[model samples]
Target chain A: MRARVLVRPKAGILDPQGQAVERALPALGFDGVRNVHVGRLIELDVEDASQLPEMCEKLLANPLIEDYEIVQ
Target chain B: MRFPGSCDDVDALLAAEMVGEAEILWHGEHNLRGVDAIVVPGGFSYGDYLRPGAIARFSPVMESVMAFAREGGPVLGICNGFQILCEAGMLPGALLTNVSLQFVCRQVTVEATGASSAFTGGFAAGARLSIPVKHTTGRFYAPAAELDRLEQAGQVVLRYAPGENPNGSLRDIAGVCNETGTVMGLMPHPEHAVDPLTGSTDGLKLFQALRDHVGSLLAA
Candidate 1:
């Protein structure tokens, strides 16, 4: 079995990298990019698909600063 | 010291151990008996891969460190050590990359957070100390409510002085202690500031505070 996790900085938390990209978009001849947020994707191969949440909680994502969505 | 890679100041620490200023023990969990305290020094542990301090949190030695913290033993984490503590869930908040996304290395002034803890006992309220910090990912972050709780509980023990927030830490926080006040994690390197040759001796008070705390325990 395989699982994929999408991790993102929580809302209201500062995302400097995302903000930098958003700021540069207008200068590069692009516009209307609002609320830009940066995140990461992690892929894993596992024996049991049900254990992904626990894995996400334990190591893949830090609950204090990030949120993770697990996909099968 | 048992980690696959050691800090740049390993020789300096060994020098401290040699002079009997500090009785450094290099043992893992099984031999942790009678260990008075644990100092997780600064360094690029685990190559800073997958973000700073993330992979090192799973190291075998941390299990012992966690047990020590649970028992109210004094544990000080500096720089990379601080990152490990946050990753291991031993401390609140997380360290993100600097707002400028550049590595910061220099001497900065930190103010005492008025929180009473074994680590900050040597300083007076509102006292400021000079400490050196070297890190790429040293910005601290926590939710607003949790930040309020930390303040209410006096867990915040240190903060960068105004105009010296080197890494965009929330509330200018430079260091924090756990609820019980035994475990502390900070980005500044006190060990590096112990001698005048390094510029200032302001960081010595931190070690003195730890010594006093441990001494009192032994006297009791």
Candidate 2:
């Protein structure tokens, strides 16, 4: 099975990368960028989708710094 | 010197003590194959220029670090290392400039948050420790709901004492573990205060815990 894990910093967490992208958007002539929080996208090929939750807990995301979802 | 001089300082300390005694690999040449555990030592790689770990995330070493973590290898990122881990998406959450907007350097009291990870297994639940935190960007922030989930899951590894809240982190959290408790990141320099002559030896337990955990895994 193929799984895509979308990981993002939790709410209220300050995302420096997101902030930087937000700042750059104005220069790119793309305004209305209220807030941008950067995150990670991890693609994996697993033997079984049932292992996704365990994968998320073990490697896909650090629960302390990120939240993640697995799309199978 | 991409980051700050502190990274160099921590590197020197680790080298002097042979913290791991493992072979060191240059940036891209190693792919973390057959590696047991990875240590993101403290250093201002890339000079801490963009953000503490912003630039280093693109470094060659990070490719190996990420791969290692993905394969379930134990990874520990200290101080600036913690910053890099977050940037590399190895850990969650972002560490921002201190809430006070000042670099804090001092010994602070920490309480174990009942985590049972390779890093904290040696300590009893609710163990109190004094470790030195030195950084301007050590404040930890996460959404309130996520913080609640972490607390409920017992993933919080260390929290600052009530009166000794050093960086204004949410719930005074000082360190945390991944859900499985294998990966960990913290702002304090446990490598710095590990020896008895260093004034506080509480940090030794962290390294020892890693060694023990890895040893047990290999034995198993």
Candidate 3:
């Protein structure tokens, strides 16, 4: 199975990288874009589909700071 | 313990030796050779490829270190070591990119908060220690409930002094120990501040605390 995990900084957690991008976009004249958030996309191959959540919970994401969504 | 790309192992070893004997335990080996305690020094382990400590947590030596910590062994982690410990689930919370989005390197003042861990007991509660912090991802975060629980349990061993936090950590936490007090992680480079010529020696008391903890364990 092929898997894609979209890892995002959890709500209420500070996303400095995203803020940087948001600020840069304003500098480039693209305005009115708010709540800019940045995250990571991880693609992987798996033999068992059931293991995706475990993989994200264990390594692909940190539950304390990030949330992961699995796409197959 | 020495992981690949660990730049501070020599300094940590020397710092550890100042209080007692020390050695470098490579990440590849599973056996710990019965070391009294473990010190995971700072560095960019595995090049910090996937979130600083994501790759290095699976090293064979960490299995032993985890087991040792479970057995009430004292384990102190510094800088990148702190990141690794959090990723390994040996400690609570995670270190995040600095709010300033810049690598911070400077002297910081941290107040001891009385976890009584091997790495923190050297100072009394409210005692302030001047140490140097050097890292980009040093901001610490945990759920609000978890933070409250930690504060209640006194697990937050060291908190940056007012206006001294380099990374904007929640509650200004600079260091923390596990519930058992045997495992600890901090962003500050205590080993780097162990000498008088380096502007301060406040870090020596932490190394001395580790030695005392190990000695007590041996005598028991």
Q: Best-fitting candidate, measured by DockQ?
A: 3
Q: How far in Å is the alpha carbon of B144 misplaced in model 3?
A: 0.9
For candidate 1, give the docking quality class from DockQ: medium
Give DockQ per model, in order.
Answer: 0.65, 0.12, 0.83
lDDT of 3 by residue, B1-220 (tens): 9899999999999999999888899999998998898989899999998799988999999999999999999999999999999999999999999999999999999999866888776688899889999999999999899999998987899999999999989899999999989999999999999999999999998999888888888999
Sorted on TM-score, highest at the top, how do the candidates line up?
Answer: 3, 1, 2
RMSD of 3: 1.1
lDDT of 1 by residue, B60-138 (tens): 7788788878988898888888998899889999999788878899999999977888789856768999989888889
- In model 2, the runs with Cα more than 4 Å from the true position are A1-72, B1-20
Better of 2 and 3 by TM-score: 3
iRMSD for each candidate structure, in the order shown: 1.0, 7.3, 0.8
* lDDT winner, 2 or 3: 3
**How do the candidates rank by lDDT, highest first?**
3, 1, 2
| CA shift of B15, model 1, Å | 8.0
DockQ of candidate 1 against the true complex? 0.65
